[model samples]
Target: MSDNASFPHGPRWFAQPGTARTWRCASAPRQVRDFHAALTGYSPTPLTELPSLATELRIGRVFVKDESCRLGLPAFKALGASWAVHRALAERAANGERRGRVTLVTATDGNHGRAVARMAHLLGQGAHVFVPRGVHRQAVAAIAAERAEVTEVPGNYDDAVRLAAEAAAGPDAVLVQDTAWPGYERIPGWIVEGYSTLCAEIDEQLAAAGVAEGPDLVSIPVGVGSLAQAVVTHYRSRPSGHAPALLSVEPDAAACVLRSLVLGRPVTVETGETTMAGLNCGTPSSIAWPYLRGGLDAAVAVRDADSARAAGDLAALGVASGPCGAASLAGLRAALSGPDAGERRTALGLGPSSVAVLLSTEGTAANPRTVTDE
Candidate 1:
């Protein structure tokens, strides 16, 4: 059933060859990582070793890139937002434009918008954030707390993106969307580039832990697939040719990336409400599609209960994570213990000695949304 039945409500897993593809980097990965390092209050987020969880999962080791806080934001979105905003402003300045202040506009389910607003606040610029209906009021208030203008669209996340795009017209505003379509790829690509810092930091942390080798697998949570794209591109493009098996996790109600990969081309879906609010995307990013198709080893969707349980499990282990952030754990469990798990594990070369890394992309306070599956 790898290629069949990719509905939004079903839990599914699909694997692919994940051939490597060439991409012309807008900026070198080192350059992007160093740029974040030079930022004020810049510090490498923790790569926590979860030996207890690893033992429970029957793996050699498990390391989670704990992204609860980065540059004063509660999610890894700040990495992309800061870099994309900086690139956009630098591009405008290169064009010799003398605008008093440029407003950054973007749409978000929650974390991305708040991160963008934080960047705009830092640069003393304006931010106009568009959120779809059903995003928690707390998330909206967080954006407003950054002194940004928050607008609620009446439809889904994609609709908010549309409104944000429309509002970003003219020289005084720049659309810093994380998803890319035709004629709007630059800023999104910059955002993808910005996410390389996470992978770079993981490498440094792993080396420090005396595990200088790459993990057998990495589970990444997908929201429009930009961060997963960054991870795939980073690993596949490595000179050492040590790209691990990359698995993307998403909510069952919003498994756009999973459904798209199942179809072999990007396809929009009827996204429903999910506890992983940050991942409630209906469509995959066009710019990220190629890299994901060519470099992602697999994609899976998990239920709200699973995400909540995963969040609780991580919290019990002293790792602070939200449902959206803990979706990686949920999906990793599904991939390794669900139907045909033995086949999947054997296929991925996973065993008792397999090492795995999960990207915990947010903290609990990042998106205070309730998760009661009705």
Candidate 2:
């Protein structure tokens, strides 16, 4: 982890200059959503506008894309995991592969494993999920409830990822990871493609609400950067002039994406302990690096206290959010109040007329007490 004493208890912002106005890849394929819509509980999540929050922040408008109840799961991971599983199976069938028993394997801090397990169960296949030490017990139990074999590793998320990759080396095992490495880009790419559903929903919902223009800013939490990459690609690929300035948020302890952007390449760092478990990743996904490099206008790293405060604030607004879910808002607050606020606000085009969308990526999956009606 970087020296926290330097960026203690606040936000550290980094601006990426010369970001491209267009995406390097094609638009998300419709078949991804087509596959998911046929499944049970396939509906768009909520795009809630919080006028009070907007007033408090002094922003033009504040929109929160809530993913708390996506696909009967507590988080948005189902969108990526389920879609990746379907694509993997479809690829097998395309090659005239024999229909044998298959098992999906991957590592997670919590939500992605549960999602993979659920998808595997739905597909009548087996799932083996690896979780790191200090993962919330509720999340592990949820994955086990799906009848997936759960293994607890002694180290952090990266260690579990290594073990899961080893387990997936078998012929009957398929790895459905959101992070990509050498020769492992295809599945992760499909996983990112799956997240397009959320972006598409946001577009339609905003249009339905009579908002002719898309948001001026989009804030997303980064783990391995897949979801952020999806958001960037979705807006940039739009035919309309709605390419919102992108903001990537990460834990101060594990700001690999920010560090990578600073170094002009991928750089791994040791992720220290963080309350936002879902965002504690030591490295950015190889597949997501290029898109993020080209699309993100700015990045910010926030402390655990920031996330906790944001969660409480959302709770006061009647939205249930875990720390990781509220991290984007935390980053937004940090960016607006930090020392570089003027430059960052100007660079991202944030102002009184600038509408911003913050993605609440999950619900209170682990700590039920974190959610409050007050």
Clashes of each: 0, 0
lDDT of 2 by residue, 1-374 (tens): 21123453233677776455555556889887788888887888889999987886678889999888878788899999988998899898898777887999999998899899989998899999999987778778888988999999999888999999999998889999999999899999999999998988888998887676888889899999999889877977766566788999999988889888877898888888888999989889998998888888888898899999999999888787888989989988887874566776777877887788899999984434222210
- Model 2 TM: 0.94
Query: Which window of ten consecutive residues has the lowest lDDT sum in model 1?
Result: 365-374
lDDT of 1 by residue, 168-283 (tens): 99778999999999899999999999999998888888889877877889999998999998988777776664557888998888888877877788988888888788999999
- Cα RMSD of all models vs. native, in order, equals 3.7, 3.3
Model 1, position 280, has a per-residue lDDT of 92
Let me know the TM-score candidate 1 reaches against the reference structure: 0.93
